[model samples]
Target: MTMDRKGLSPDQLKEMYRQLLYPRLIEEKMLILLRQGKISKWFSGIGQEAIAVGATLALDPDEWIMPLHRNLGVFTARNMPLSRLFMQWQGMQEGYSMGRERSFHFGSPEHHICGMISHLGPQLAVADGAALAYRLNETSRVVLAFSGEGGTSEGDFHEALNVAAVWDLPVIFLVENNGYALSTPVQEQFRCISIADKARGYGMEGITIDGNDLLTVYDTIKGVRDYCIRNQKPYLVECTTFRMRGHEEASGTKYVPDALFDLWAQKDPIAQYEQQLLKEQLLTEDEIASIRQTLKQQIEAELEAADSGSTLIIDTAAELDAVYAAPAITALPTVTDEMPATEKRFVEAIRDGLYQSLERDAQLVIMGQDIAEYGGAFKVTEGLVAVFGKERIRNTPICESAILGAALGLNLEGKKAIVEMQFADFVSVGFNQIVNNLAKIHYRWGQAANVVIRMPTGAGVGAGPFHSQSNEAWFVHTPGLKVVYPSTAVDAKGLLMAAIEDPNPVLFFEHKALYRSISEPVPDEPYVVEIGKARRVQEGTDIAIITYGMGVVWAEDYAAAHPEISVELLDLRSLQPLDHAAIRASVKRTGKVLVLHEDTLTGGIGAEIAAWISEHCFSMLDAPVLRCASLDTPIPFNTELEKNFLAKQRLEQSVEELLGY
Candidate 1:
């Protein structure tokens, strides 16, 4: 047989045909297992195998491929063992995800392939971030990120594409436009003529192609990959195809039009490729039959092996350990009385911490809005850009989700990214990525999200609801994330340094009100204030006031004015890994507890601390565990109203009541 015009030899073409057949056969067996009650569910890519195989085959082995749920052929093309695939489907402990996650929600770091999360668009930015890392590391590798046409509507899609184009990252976004996004048809999903056309808006080339044609897909992807590698730029390719089956096994094809299904069935990619190979005299009918029989037997054997493997029961201890792996505390350069300390503002201290971390680690990258030229929204990263250069300190568009998602990708590529959300309130825009993707990544796939999100939080200076919000509780509630809110300049620098070094995701909330308002003597040398440990601000015996961030100042001020109440002030810097020992010790000594925070009264970190005190140190408490926080309402814009809303008088009154009790 003659070699194909797309540069594939007869053997390579046959191998491509085999790759297409494997996923189809595997899905068919998965459906059978589903019917037999051996599997819980299945999402089959029956008609889109050619697109997956072609796109992956065109990339170099070192280049990364982030696949969606329907792109099983991509895994098969990458030479993933069929038995391991079955093990994943069978939920065995030996699977890639160790049976922790179901379906295609697992990735192989060894293969440089990221598994898909339920939310589709986040991976787009992650792929772009990985590409950025490759460029910085001066590697020839590129990245291919896949998503459905439906995911194009998500904010992450636009953010990722825009960032990739602006930075000229080597990322190829392959969109599988399979006509429908689950139940919604293409016509209803978007008004645009083609999903690929959107790439033009992002200053990147966009191409639409027939995804069902194996050779066409292979040729198009090869050309696109070459362009991305050569120019260090991004390209978007939309592979127009159809989903021949339901979204999942139990979903049924009832929502699909029978006529449309019949129309696409005639264009079955596998059958078409087989006929093409036969027409070219590359394979006989007997050879095709032999290939099918061999694949079927191999799949069945894998299934048998997986079914005989030991089932994985949930390990509670392991689950807890995986949620948050605490970083070890390393000894810092000792401070001597002869060494003078510098008086720096809270923001300056944070900048110093970042400067030190960047100086120490070449892999550290800072990303946020206005972070490069403007030096961040609050100027916390000011002047450092000139010191570190634009490559290390990047200015991202106002895209919180993509910024965080891309940071995760950078972390995956061995680069630590510190993402700054201009305001704490704006973080809600990227809440899904944080709660679902970042927080759950380690627990589900064992991927470390070593990224720090710097949130300027608080309710002062009359910045109103949007700008002034202490939203630390949201992250503290998340299992896999570490939360830190430092009140003083010294702790701010120390904790920020520690957060940068930690191997887990840390939300570093810098009080917006304290940026220029507070100043203290900070160590010039690098130091790491251990995460999850509380600092004893002042030691006293009458009352133990436990707080963090701006609340610590309030507690100190109240104690100074009264002079009668002997308060043991403790700053609980880290919220998630709460210093229970400190809390119990203080409560045991004083027999009085007051949990104060600037966040709203209900469902605040204060409430969690109060509850812990009630549960653990109930007998030691002299008065009912007291709590003081902002009113459970949006922070008012007016200064007077805000003061009334988050009144210090109310806290003083509560303290008086507690002392009386």
Candidate 2:
């Protein structure tokens, strides 16, 4: 009964021994269940148990940990109920994801665990996000981010590390160098002496440790945590361990050399730790046997409880309901028509709306490249930096994936974040973070990513291909996201505020063409235009044009000029939670319908709208449903080519054709 230099009492070491043994023993049981057809899959952390156990025990209660798939020790160390863990793996109704997700692809914010997606590299950036939140909220919460040697090869790994270092974020970039990622060996992964060596390039301290030595890992992490908190800086640690089992229960280790297995067997972490405790006389042989028996009985009981739980029920209404959190439209002020003393341009209205939002909510933070001092790419955030200061109006590196991931982290900490993409086209860089992480989090784990991604979108202003592209369709197709594309200054301001105030992630697309080109009366006072509601721009009895974003502008112009044709234009402000109610009402009024959009023809939102009209309002139609959209090609650089490629040039022809029909 003696203490170590790091103040580890004999009793504490005995408890650590128990915690370490739990996952190792349970993992063996899980593999048996997998073979017996009781479970679906198993990612064994048999030999690498010390990494998760040591790290979790070292962390404070408020600190967040982003663990990978094999880190069951982190959960067991937190003392999570064995029954609930069994239910989650079995996909029961009471599971963490309610049967929507499986394995470790789930998060528990209440437990200070940031869930990781399959894309391992993105979690590094998300760890930076929670660290950034800690900085903003002054929480002093350090974060431990886990990645494998193969994941370090991803671009997000570099971007996240560089940003965290430059910003001096309180995070420990822990790489569990488990020798192989799936089947790729460490030599093929990188040429660096070790993963920790790469940390020097980011101007951060780095270290490598024996992952199998339990006490060493526990003590090292405690010191790293202290260093991060003390200096508000990032640090990197590489734990050289071996994945004892195959990648999973199915993928046998035929590729692994027999000599390596012999090498790691002698260094088995659990076996080594058990001997250390026995030598110190912490627990006798009988006590160890009794502990094992108790764990076996408990696991069996938990497995039985999981099996006896009610089977998952498939409800169509419930399935649809779970896709996106119901929109918080009830908060919208019922004043859509109140006029202001003066008119503001689309960009000004957005700026005004954002200013109002920031003034209203202290927890709301806006991050983007050049957004703080230079006022964003389009100057939409101009002069607001002076008003709000750098903390709230923060400028970030050109790391879209990291920033978007970080925004989700901010949302986890009960803060609202607005990420301004310099151009809508650049959203491609962060697409996975948006679609997979942010979009799926709410549906998978019921934690809404309550963030606003401002897409300064559409093809206009001669910015050319990369800078000018209408890519709203990408997000429109994603279920857990709300897509808002406003055409007028009023809707831009109103929808901007609404998207900011939403309880779920919202992609608010502000068309660049309307930023300065259009001026309309807008209320100086703040108000929210309800999302999922379409605005009827003009009343017509002839042909109805259903459109969003720039398509609304062109349709309005055409309707104004052609006095002979009574054209009804429906401006769908929100695309995903599309105003089906309004679209149905408009098509019934004007049977001949035309769906128009600025995006490319084939997969644009126009097709979805056209299909819906055909299905529900076919009997009311006087003519076939026609679509006006850009050619199925990239937005060109030349003016004439761009114009020809737009739905605007084809608008008059499609309207005349539909009218004649």
Candidate 3:
């Protein structure tokens, strides 16, 4: 008689059993520690161990795997140092994130594992990006993204699935349907019969299987993995299992029915696999006891070794370097007020900056909505597709979150991506991927997201509330992000060059009002202006206008019109890692200073400048630092109302009030 082997030998089956046993024993050890007050918390993957072990083993070891909160078996299966994992749980200095992030909230690039963020769905999009890189490189490596059933409800999950299907990316989405999402059951999460059924909507092939059977997970994923690599297509596999433990140890499982527990108890993956090995004569009862004893002893020893490591404490000075991959841009030598002979608009200079970068770097790809043959909504990239083709200047779906996540994915393989937001307001939809994932990746995992997001921002041309609002303050408050806003065409080109060359994520804000309105003699040759440098538009002794973007326009015009005022205007090219020396020098030169910005008066960037001046430059100030800003209201669609709502309306008056004081 012949039996189905599923291409596995007895030794391989025994090895699979050993691999699957690690997470269960490790989880039991953690539970003992939790009760003893040695560990704070843990998300138990007790009953669903088969999906993690089997799915990880199905793919090649070098391929990428983005694990979910409950997939602790992936870590053990990857053979991560048990000592380091214990240290990570204890917030030791030798842990993966250097104690910056706790628990499974960190990634290990050496192991080709992308870490999980607390947010459920955005990481799925990030996994799609890694697959996109493999597709671009023409490598057969596939990426596995693990998600719980509840995570599929998020828009990001749908967007990621849609992109992978449309692009035919090499990815295997593993949905571990454990019947409960926190306290909410799978029934309340979606109307579909199974998570795999949702794949039909995205035009992808899918399967649903018995997750409690280790053989089913191994067999299904192994076959699906080959299909993904061979055809470069996405496949969804939903493994139906039960989470025997609560969401965490803190959240009790009282809501689950007693009968449900009794039903699932008979289907426990480790017990079923062990019994199968006995029935197949692969292992004896003595060998099973010996394996369990050996694993428990090993866990205790590793835990004790990790306990001996040094504890991690908050070191703000040491942590400062990890926040940004590159050093802050320094001030350059002052230049004369003479213009070069050549000329270009701010948009033209921006186009030149992008074109020059693309022309030089073969690995760079530009992704955005309507940015391909259309050259973007503003035609900033017009005629480029005719030169570089659509693959490099790619048009993307209207999914900001996915695009941002993909940009980070593209960065994983040393390739760079430049993302263009159609309007700055659209960034709200992509905010989590930017602030939570991209910005934090460098600090948490030492992974640099070498991407530039061109924010077509600010209100002036009556683009209304959705299209025209100054939202720079939102990023200014976020750590690990660089903010750039240039006023002149030359500065736009130079600053954009610096942003692209920087090793981390940069939010390049280009005011829509100044794009076509401002023109200057910009040099054809490529050059990089320092990001944190503040350029002096004019020098005077009486007062100084500290501003950026459109504020520079209003201040420069006001100063030019009133020559007798002896005004000095400063244009801050960068916001984060701001040029404090320039600000102090200007404050020291002039007795009075006024902070100006186009954003609303409350909670604007100007407020920070004013507060800093008051704290650091109070002795030099003849009067208090004053702020001139727009009223706290949305930018109006009406032309006249917009003018009334802008800071330019009260700029001259605010300057006069400061001068009089």
Candidate 4:
């Protein structure tokens, strides 16, 4: 068939042809390399090459681009060397090179390519977060996020789209509709006719483009990009494309009908564009032939360069250094020597801790919803933005997953990230990131995910189920995560400081009611309370009460009021590495025990304590270990119901019964 090129410049046509030719050649070579044991398995965007080249050509290199598996066009356009890309596919240590590799999902920031993730859809929020940071930082840069049509099925996609649209973030959502997701086709995935149409629900402009037409794709992307740059508005572009190859190397196309293949063959973007180049006289047959030869030679050269190179050798020491680059605790300021003996309130201690930590570590960053200028939902971060500047104290777009994901990436890059959830109840939004990614990094890859997550938790605020929750049990049960619940301002400051300096991921639970109502002798100076160390708040020989966070205060008060009942109160600071030593000592001494917390009695930390005691100290106990905690019902909005929901005071009454044992 004679290819026709019409209404296009020679240079433009040449660029488009070159884009298609080189990437396809490279992809094929990489696959061959896989067979020859030269490279690892790779996902190719062969049939959808036109859109990849077209869409990326219109983006700003300085602006961020979060690439997925099908974005070979993006990396190539951004100037990622062909040999290096091949090396990475081969799993070479040099192949893992990126100046900002950890931050951008393994993409080189210098190349303006953010990292690609295998986790389907969450990268959309991460791109938006980078855009959010840019907006806050007053940079003119935008973010272009790419994903497949199937990823739209994830809640992260909609959450990201809605957040970006409502906030008018400078982001472009590019959805490459490549026919099928492994085996599931778009027909079976959603009822929506086009992915772009979903953007309208978010009150954003949506466009459906012919992904094959190079000029058409370019013009469409360019227009939306300009719109975003000028108005800071976000847009969604649905690039209708097809995957000519099977899902992966092992998959076959036996399920696809010949008729569908025939129809798509006629509309092959590369062929159509080649036809246009010839038809428009943009290039003679000889010129097109010559260009093709040159591209083929270039691809051959890259393949040779990669093949001649030795197998990727990883440096164990360098990898260890990369994984263990967290700052030492000695680098942080400690307040043990300067702490005043006077009493202080819980909120004051938190404020002091934040200020001191920020002063000590300039790399420390705190971001959350309403944190900038608004202080915090509970005013814990009050005056922080004014002291630390907006760059350090950032305000996010209400995407909890995005907030946590960005924090994970930042922490990976050796930046200390501290994020707060308005209420612990809403933490469920980003629970997947915490449990799956945060908790797994240290154990899975030996990478320290140094992140401090603060949440105002527990009931009694009358905020109801949606607002009031003590869900530390959820993460405490999760391994590789440290949970800290402090009742006193002194403990809050000390534990929070320790969490910031520690190498592991720490979850700090700050009770909202205690923020103002509770007070203790907290030093104005900095101090770090050791993790996994329990403090004896009150001395008693009759029975030991083990609790944490706000529950510790109630346990102390209950012990103090009951003179007839000599209660030993132990505050277990860290949940993961529970203070078994203190628990054993108290149980063995008193010969009785009581476990307490603000969370529900069922499956709470108290349950674990009871189990542990039964396992180790069952023979030494004078009576069965009892539990004092909230009821199983959700916190109610009514004050009376909320008060009645707690088991602390009721447990105080129950202590009398336990003493009888």
Looking at model 4, residue 537 earns an lDDT score of 76
The CA lDDT at 173 in model 1 is 95
- Per-model TM-score versus the true fold: 0.97, 0.98, 0.97, 0.76
Model 1, 404-475: lDDT tens per residue? 989989977899999999898999999987888888888777888889999999887888888888889888
Write one digit per residue (lDDT tens) for candidate 2, span 1-661. 4434368888888888888888998999998888899899999999999999999999996688999899999988877788888888888868888888888888887788887898888988888888988998787679999988889999999999998998889999989998888999989889988998999999999999999988989999999999998899999999989989989978989889999999999898988888888887887889899988988888888777777788779998887788877666544474456455359999999999899999998989999999988999899999998999998898998899999988988887788899999998998999999999999988898887889999998886776889888888888888899999999888888888988888788999988888999997888888888888999988889989999888887888888898899888899999988989899888999999999998989888989999998899889999999999998888889998888888898898998898888
Q: Which pairs of residues collide in candidate 1?
A: none
Better of 3 and 4 by TM-score: 3
The clash tally of candidate 3 reads: 0
lDDT of 4 by residue, 13-114 (tens): 687778776777777776786688755466777778887787787777777787787778888877777766765565444454422133123556567665
In model 1, where do residues sit more than 4 Å from their true spots? 1-4, 326-340
For each candidate in the order shown, give its overall lDDT on alpha carbons: 0.88, 0.88, 0.89, 0.77
Where does the lowest 10-residue lDDT sum fall in candidate 3?
Answer: 330-339
Clashing pairs in 3: none
Q: For all candidates, what are the clash counts?
A: 0, 0, 0, 18
TM-score, cand. 3 vs. native: 0.97
- Model 1 worst lDDT window (10 residues): 328-337
Q: Which 10 consecutive residues of model 2 have the lowest summed lDDT?
A: 332-341
Error of 4 at 178 (Å): 2.7
TM-score of model number 2: 0.98
lDDT of 3: 0.89
Better of 2 and 4 by lDDT: 2
